[model samples]
Target: MADDGLDPRRWAALALLCAANFMVILDSQIVLLALPSIERDLGFSGGGAQWVLSAYLLGFGGLMLLGGRTADLVGRRRTFLAGTTLFLVSSLLCGFAWTGGVLVGARVAQGISAALMAPSALSVVTAMFAEGTERNKALAIWSSVGGFGATAALLVGGTLTDALGWPWVFFLNVPVAMVLLALGPVLLSESRGRARAYDPVGALTVTLAVSAAVYGVVRAPETGWTSASTLGALGVAVVAGAVFVRVETRSAAPLVPLQIFRSRRLTGGNLVMLLTAVGAFGTSLAVSQYAQGVLGYSPLEFGLATAVLPVMAVVGSYAAQAMIGRVDVRPVAMTGMAFMAAGCLALGQVSENSGYVTGLLPGLFLFGLGLGSSAVAAAVAALSGATERDSGLASGLNTAAFQLGGALGVAVASTVAVSRAGAVPGFRAAFDTSAGIALAGVAIAGLLLARPRRRRVPEPVGVTMSKEESTCGT
Candidate 1:
């Protein structure tokens, strides 16, 4: 570390970490475009086809907290490399899968790998840069890269699936993972927490709780929300969650320290991320359905047309980063949410006869801008107040919130889109509901985050600040 408390190779390390972040996010969205090809090739029966996506999500969301805590206990670099190696093997398995069952299993493995990689990579970044302007810039780049990854998936997935085959979608990760594995040890430093005790009971209960909750929400659209299976899964989640909390409270070395929630900024930041994801994912689903189903655009064409969203998002992220250096996060976050609400409202005005240039582009542009800005602000706010020891745990909680929100968004939007009389009307209703959600986020941000009366200079490493002081200025 330098006198400034930043790593000497922080930029190079950031590039590598951002690449990993991009790959993980890419896999999440890329598979959506290739689902039909996967279903046909593997001879999927009934709704088993959806499992390709759901399996990944369940494993990723379920094991996320454990993955984060593991990083703090074991080692960040080792955990990241282990995850990357597993991801490489799983990608190959997915490419060569001969049956639907085999493919779904491989996808679950991929998700598990991602759960390990995501938080460890983020924790490494947080550890590398001191919390201030430097950290804000780094996170802005990370957030923009993530936004680019999702849209790039749409573009790349369509092109690869059409030109080569759906298998290439899986094959694409092989080289990237190989490169990360090669450079990781050379570029990254190894670090672990002082507390070395493992909490198996807490881990098991929390994992089960999150997995059950994710499964319940992911399946609710297919099976009626009121069905026995849905209720049962949710009940399991509730029970498991209670058990985990009890275990953590008693454990000498808990998986997640209950006191971490005492930071108002951390809690508020996570909630903002959750609500932002709810609107972002729900709107994406609604727009994709409208463009492909209603507007009659091929997958490739659709991808090409909507590319503006991510482009504008990249622009917005950098702009937000500059703004955050001067002002606090609360205004930036609220402004971003306001933009998102306006975008959704614009999308809700689309009709059957509307054109892309006039009806869709404007809404997408606004939404993408908001996505980039809000994501960076939320991330900075959430991690800014965390002590170095709890960084991994905080990163995990933030990620889990986003993933869970995504599952909820897709399910609720799918249900809302089909509830109306016609396709266009149903899509419009979903967009309108998404707008409402974004507006609610604005209110929550205002209520939860405090405005700092004055800016504070960055403190040196190992310097402790009061909880109230730490919550004020991120």
Candidate 2:
């Protein structure tokens, strides 16, 4: 054990960080299942109810870059603690919310807090773990933990909403957040990225760009994709994005350095994250809809049935972690994409007469497995060569990709599904499209994630490489 308390107990620190990440994931998903219940209790009008979710998405998706950069500017431990405190307070506020407006406001607060908490916690993981097998394993576990949080919310949310009321969903996060806050100081050590002056222009432009893009994507399903509102929002995103790039070029201390794009691994990993999120989130939506609308599964039944997916995800994550130690990340990621494609393809078999056992089970398992594997691989690859200075940015960028991808996935899948002859057929169409996206990811993994080969120097006569030595770096 080193003198630093965190070195010897790094895994434990990972657990705490992952727990924070899990809370963020859980809060997002848990609210989904309880939306109906919340609306009824709060007497929310039909159109207004959507704001509960949209507000949170806006806050979270838009501010991720700012949050990550803030972590880099401040200290990771301080950011984590501050964010957790805000999240805790917001969760409490959500639980006590008597009106729809209050609840939505609280949710936005939670989203902002999460935007701060997530990148800091993840960057801490990269900082603590050395970039090798240990980091790979830690990332795998982190991915698995998030998977469990998402899946668990599906089950737990339904149960809580039915039995204990919708407030319990938010209330549950309070204790968990409190526990993490209490333990974190003792269990974790403080760390900061390279000190740099804040880039207000870069932050402002990127925040507006991302927030507008995500808002447009989220609204497309409700508002026509080509509607004036949607088009205007998208136009704003494009303009803002362009301005952001220009700002970064001129700024001495850009929030996200332009040089990060030069690394194929970083760029590829983010793209892969985006593509896989499209497949995974789209499939989850399809599965949920199919189970309830076509197959007539109750909320509880749907939750129970979908529970198996997370179990498979855990197994897949562990498998990926073990395999990553011995192989390149591209193959692992490609293999995961293949599994996702296969799962989506299998789900294309769903029909009105089909049952859960035959129709959804196989696809669910495969999708979960692929989700777990690819999430870990892509995350590790995204942060592959990151130092402390850019670690937070890397985390924030990956998270933003995931959020944007999920929004686009849901919007596109829903649109495609509805455009077809019937709901069931539309779902199948969406599943097929998701499979196509996953297949695209497989190709991208090959093209973008390939490591450059190193040229071998001819060894002197009688000289030999060690048993494990290779001509090229893995």
Candidate 2: regions farther than 4 A off: 1-6, 454-474
Tens-digit per-residue lDDT, 143-215, candidate 2 = 8887777667777888888789989988998888999899999887788877899999999999999889988
Task: Please count the clashing residue pairs in each candidate, in the order shown.
Answer: 0, 0
TM-score of each: 0.95, 0.93
| Candidate 1 lDDT tens digits, 73-145 | 8998999999999999999999999999999999999999999999999989888888889999999999899
Candidate 2, residue 94: lDDT: 93
Positional deviation of residue 350's Cα in model 2 after best superposition, in angstroms = 0.7
Cα error, residue 109 of model 2, in Å, equals 1.0
Instruction: Report lDDT per candidate.
Output: 0.86, 0.83
lDDT, residue 169, candidate 1: 92
